[model samples]
Target: MFRYYFLVIYTVYMLLKHIKLLYELQTLDPRLSYAKQMEAVYDKPKSFMRGCIGLTGSTVSIHQFGKTPKGPVLYVHPKLKLADLAVLLGHLDKTPSFFAEPRAFRYPLVHQWLNKMGAIKKNGGEHTAVEQIEEIVRKGQSFILSEADGIDYESLSSRLGVPIVPIETSGIEDMQKGSFFKRLKPADLDLTIHRAYLPENKRLRA
Candidate 1:
């Protein structure tokens, strides 16, 4: 009886694994599409104005600031209009978005597929700018904006095998001169909402 039960459980586990992989494969196109759209929005090849957006102090307000040689100058005010924010985030319903550490994807098969499709590249050039940022801080001088001018953030993220947010965090840590980070709690909410809900059998394993 014990041997029969063990065999049945093993079979079910394998079945669930393959099923999950298949479902991920089906969603590949939408994921790729969203990635492309984000690239289009954030990175304008011909736009010469270099800027970054961040929260201003503890206030609820935020600032879109131009990166300058001396310091960041406020370029835009308060908040984005509802319509503009919606246009920026319109792709959220089509697919899930979150920050994943470099080379640490929850779905290995999906990561492999993305690489095969040329959605991201893992060349040695990855993190070159990140390392440069660290070195600039070591010399006790400001790393001016011009140092990073003309670099495409979307392309850099692709090469680094992660999202742009991680790059932001990397620069932040270097500026603060230490690391203060913890892994965020993982949940199945994105999977469920995106209609790629995991099989019950694989939940615990995942």
Candidate 2:
């Protein structure tokens, strides 16, 4: 009876593991349309992180800033107007997206379980930007803007090898009605995507 039960449990565990892997595979994919844009832009490549961009400090208010839950994970990127940032993400092909061993368990459940069982220590603690390129930030899709923004943010960009883009948009009367950033009417937003950063090099522009 015990042997049969053990075998049954083992089979179920393996089946679940396979199912989880498949689920992780499906959710972790680059956006197709955005992927094309990334290839074109990168062919004439502007920055190391082709799709990701950094926003200005003033624009960071649109997001709710808070610390990430402490576990085996690390919190990167501050946020604001994630919807707006979505408009700018670049897409990548499968080749560049997954060229290495994945960082965390492709499935969050496995990551959490292993961490709880003391099988894994510090989730994001052991990861590098390359492993995450396919997991968190798709190679092609532009990055979601994070919390704090400024010259300091260049460090994160440098680490990720992505570009920084600052946008000056119109139609801000509602957001900055009482402040100096207020505008009366909608107009064309001027956006400049800065050059990409190499992890080991210094940039000419500040």
Candidate 3:
């Protein structure tokens, strides 16, 4: 019985140790820089312009949506080609902003896409997504990208005066379908829980 109890305790301790390691790795992810940049632009006032919003789906679906009256007249479809996104980013002459969400930094793939982009100064405060959108527009931001799959395009379009375009990518829709808790596997939850214990950093890396 003692031996069995010792084994159980050892297992639990190892599991916790694994969780700590994962949290550390997540904090070190380079994409966190991108997330911070996005946050900065969303919250602050700066000279931004030509702000466009995009909703991604399958490439074929985007084409079909574009035909309708509600479809965006113009957009960029990266189609999971980071190079394409990079080119579009270059053309913008500024880093695009992102909708506020924890997954923006926590998810590597999404952050990888947004990393190293530009960011405006921060206004600082808890703001709703709609409010952030308005703030970004007021500051003259050119584009705002939603978290991969969490935003309600219809609700946002109805609330805002700007046009919300559908820009289809090959795999992004599926990739971010469950970016947060709903998507996490049982084994991954421990790391997420551990992340919450870390001190939050409000000021983004420059």
Candidate 4:
């Protein structure tokens, strides 16, 4: 009986130690901790920009949603490409009035790609999929793509009190075709979510 008890205690201690190690590792790396990142960005006025919005579609541009400056914001869509980044940069240059999330001028991917061309260490960290996402949203940024409608944008917006500028995108297969004009589409105009915390006074406009 004593032997069994000792073994059980040992097992429990080992499990707890493992869990503690994981928690410590996660806490040590800000890139691995989305909640920490979100808390860091929330309420930081210096990062916020008024009336500025981000735009992107689906897999390729999903990273855009995680980019935020600090203030009244929204996102526009239809999947974008390298050229779209250039165009957006031009727009930012032309209109100091607006700040766009995931500023095309400072794209992480562009930096990574350039580094790759030069044989430098370029891939971003290997964070878990959910952590990567949570880091993005909690940081007061929004994304245009979701596996389902309800999970990401709505939940994050409700938690952060940030309005989501949701936009739909064609699936990955349709997006690979390289035609510029063919890719842009007017987003689906009528989508709604019935949430308890959403401000009861304001109606989502078309």
Candidate 5:
């Protein structure tokens, strides 16, 4: 009786191991419809933009800014405008938006805000800053208009070999409105704020 019982337990253990192996094989099979469905669900989008916000002390309000397929997008606080936020969120394929370091003059307040939003880290060494920007650019991204002028933008554009578009925010009124769901139209200001930063190749292409 004891010998018979031992044989049955051993057989059951082997059978269970084989069943587990079969389940794993089914999961690993690419041709399986379930596997294909999983891939489709997790696939990344092709065209995505990197959004940035630049805050100035003189302005007293933060700006929502980013680059788009056509060019740059500049407005006020995104969360304050439901329509604009919807437009931005719709455009996000799979890429992320990053707010780079604000100017040194407004470091204290800006840094605190960024920390709360988890947008950026405190300013590290020069080498680290370069590495951060390079990594973001390599991932096919662009920054929104903060203090990015001609020279700073030119340096970044040359290093990344990508065009840096500056979204102009001079003429966008109603940005200081009360409701967070306000409507916004494109401003009619001169859009050539960082024209000098554009590369020769990009200019020729344009």
Candidate 6:
């Protein structure tokens, strides 16, 4: 009985230790300084992203939240390509943004395959996966949601009781251009999130 009890205690301690280590690693992710530079070049105050939802089709343009925004902000993106996402994420204005990784992406089999193929790149968040981030948003903390498509955004807002700013990335023109090397350049691409429908209270603020 004593041996069993000892084992239980040891397991609990190790679990706590693992959580702590994960958090520390998260904090170590480098902040993207280029976010400011991008802002300077564009200098279009009108293109700034506001907290809202619903957009027609979707468009991609370079966006870096410039101001220190008030209230809970959720940034959603259909970030599929690992390299493109890395560029966008690295330039985000917010620090230590929580990233919600889909459970499938975290599955051992999928994770191993992606990692081996250089598809599973890190984007600075240690507390990954949807459930973990859902808890964070519940506590009224803002995050960069790692969900793609309209359905995921709607579901997340319903589940969390907060507005999500949808970011839709496109390379229609860039892809048409057909420069293989250019397509690979993260800096060359544009990023956009929607702002079609604004809440009543939010409408007043804007």
Q: Which one wins on lDDT? A: 6
Candidates ranked, most accurate by TM-score first = 6, 5, 3, 2, 4, 1
Q: How does each model score on TM-score?
A: 0.20, 0.28, 0.29, 0.28, 0.35, 0.40
Error of 6 at 46 (Å): 24
State the C-alpha lDDT per candidate.
Answer: 0.26, 0.32, 0.33, 0.32, 0.35, 0.41
Please state the error at residue 31 of candidate 5 in Å: 16
Which model scores highest in TM-score? 6
Model 3, runs deviating above 4 Å: 1-87, 91-95, 99-127, 170-206
lDDT for each residue of candidate 3 in 1-206, tens digit (9 for 90 to 100): 33334434653454354444334444444545443434443321122110111112112122132122221111223232332242233333234544333445455433433332222222233245446555554443434443443445445444444344334333323323353322211111000000011012322111
Candidate 2 structure quality by residue, lDDT tens digits, 1-206: 33334434653465465554434443323555444533442332122122222121122222212221111111223333422332222221121221111354565454543222122222333244334432333333443333442224445555555544332222222322223332222222222333233344654222
How big is the RMSD of model 1?
Answer: 19.8
* Candidate 1 residue runs with Cα over 4 Å from true position: 1-110, 124-206
TM-score of 5: 0.35
lDDT of 4 at 121: 20
Q: Comparing 1 and 4 by TM-score, which wins?
A: 4
Residue pairs clashing in model 1 are: none
In candidate 4, position 31 carries an lDDT of 59
Please list the residue runs of candidate 2 whose C-alpha ends up more than 4 Å from where it truly belongs after superposition: 1-79, 82-134, 147-171, 174-185, 204-206
Location of the lowest summed lDDT over 10 successive residues in candidate 4: 45-54
lDDT of 5 by residue, 84-150 (tens): 3222322333223344444622643334323322233425645665566566556443333244311
lDDT of 6 by residue, 1-206 (tens): 33334434653454354444333433333453333322232222112121000011223456534343444556766655533444345444442233324553565333432232123224434434455556545544556656542235555665666665655555534422234323211123466645422332343122
